[model samples]
Target: MASSMLAPAVGDIAKEFRASDKAALAGQTSFVCMLGIGPLFLAPMSETFGRRKVFVVNSAMFTLLQIPTALSPNIASFIAFRALSGFFGSVGVANGGGSIFDMFDVHERAPVLGFYLTAPLVAPSIGPLLGSVIVRSLDWRWIFWCMCMLAAFVTTFIYFFLYETNPVAILQARKSELQKKHPDVEYEVEGASDESIPKKIMNASDLTCSPENGTRAVKILTTQPIVLILSSYQALIFASMYSLFATYTDIWSQPPYNFTTIQTGLAFLGPVVGFVTMSTLVILYIDSIYNYVARKNDDDGLPEYRLVFANIGAVLLPISLFMFGWTVEMGLAWPVPLVATVLFGASQVSIFNPVQTYYIDAYAKHAASALAAGAFLRSMIGGVVPLFVGQMCVFPSTSTRRF
Candidate 1:
């Protein structure tokens, strides 16, 4: 949400800070890049320290960083603060799938994951809509202020309600408690063995702060063929999505459309409706499809079964992109383009849910690391692509073809 929240106010921000268009775009880029980068480290850290601790600490810092962001006096400072906040704010993105994997069985994961993914998937579309309204009625800075309030509330909710879900961490904690109660008796977690007292202490420390654990996500990204292919495919989709988002204001605020700021914001409703509707329907049927396929395969559910909906998305994505591009290029009715966006939104959730659930199922114990790997590539591309959208929009037909 923070990544594209200021998008609607880019022109206003550029005027106030005397920034060039590219410089203003950097405000969005900086946040998005850090959002991708943070998971590379934070996801592994969650595996080490536990999800609840990482979530609470990062959420608090993320909340605090919004204050400086809201008060940024220049584009450089604005970009810097947004970058820092994005890094801290990625705790959920980094660890959420892993936590869900820890809690749910494979048969039950799809629907729960569908619901869990709605926030990250849909919130980006919602952000610009809210931002347009805020920029129209209040100062652009108020967008960050509103985000600050929301972040504070989220931070509080997480601190009070979130619990450690990492199985290893829980077992380690239980072992520690047992050791404390019976100092004379040696205790060990599942994979570890009883040893001398000093060696036990060293092993415990290593378990909690291992460098191998910290680099696990990067290792998986580089080594796994499935991770590489899926992440790359998702990256392309994310990049195209961000490109469209960055150009929305430029497209709608101009002569052919001449939409008011609020109307332009309202245009986002098409995608929002698509996102909600598809996600709800998927939540209702994803598990059933998985079960049916598993029964057909002698009660063995492969991760590939999850790709069923992805096939639908693969078909819809290109069709919708072509529709959206040609309709806007032909200067058709605004609703025509909006209807294309609706299909685009539906296609996104269709792809995202299955890909994500496949990751969790394929790498159950290392679900967070698997997800982090995918998020890293997609987010980095998503962030960088928007920086070139203005140039690409100069040749709308060519850009649409390239996409």
Candidate 2:
């Protein structure tokens, strides 16, 4: 939610800091890039140290980092601190699905994941809506200040409520307790002998230095055909959303439909509605579709069955893109572009849920690494594409092509 605020406030940030749109946008882009990149490191760290520990530590850091971003006097400092905040906050993005799988059975995951998946995707759209109001009423710095307060609240909540959900971590703790109770009887960890606390710590350090996990991530990216294709496909979808977020503020504030900051933020309601409606419907029906498909295949479910909704999204996505482009380019009725946003957001819900679930099912043991690779690809594209969106959206014939 906080991350998405910058899209609506980029103009105000640029005006105050005496920076170009692209430079102010760099503050957002750098955060996104680090948000994507941080997961690769933290995902592996969670495997070594445990998810609860890593999550709490990173959440604390995320809250602290937001302070500098809110207090930054210049664009450079804001961008740098924003990037650092993203790096720490991304722990949730990367590990969230893994934690979900740890808690729920496969059959129960569809509806639960539907809710989980929609929150982050819908948040970017929702953030701009509130940001427009905040920016209108206050200086741009207040935007970051609001986010800081929210993050601090969340960090405190997580510290108290969140538990270590990783089965391996839980089992290890149990074994340690049993070992203390019965020191003479040998209790063995699978695949390796039990070591003392200090020795285990050293082994974790050794594993961190090992090249195996790095090689595995690279191999997954390069060698796995499904992972590669889906990662690329999702990257484009994520990039399109970011493009809209980045461009909408500038476009709405200009000529044929000049709008105030608050009004521009209100425009995001269309996408928010679309995302909510689509996600709700999917949660209601996704499991039924899986059940129907499973019965047809002699009571066995396949990961491929999830792709049914994804194909529906495939059809709608391109059509919506065309609708959005034509409506905005021709300066049609205000509702036309807003309706197009609805379509685009609906399409994203259809596509993202299945692709994410399929990855977890297909690579259950290695799901973390697989997801990290996908996150990296999608975020890199999302981060980099916005830099060129302003240039690409311009038409030579249109006067005042400010976006």
- The number of the candidate with the highest lDDT is 1
> Per-residue lDDT tens digits of candidate 2, residues 79-102?
899889889988877788778877
lDDT of 1 at 329: 83
CA RMSD, predictions in order: 4.1, 3.0
Model 1 collision count: 0
Error of 1 at 153 (Å): 0.5
Candidate 1 minimal-lDDT segment of 10 residues: 394-403
All candidates: TM-score: 0.92, 0.92
Per-residue CA lDDT of model 1 for 190-213, tens digit only, reads: 643445655533443343434355
lDDT of 2 at 24: 92
Off by over 4 Å in 2: 191-215, 395-403
TM-score of 1: 0.92
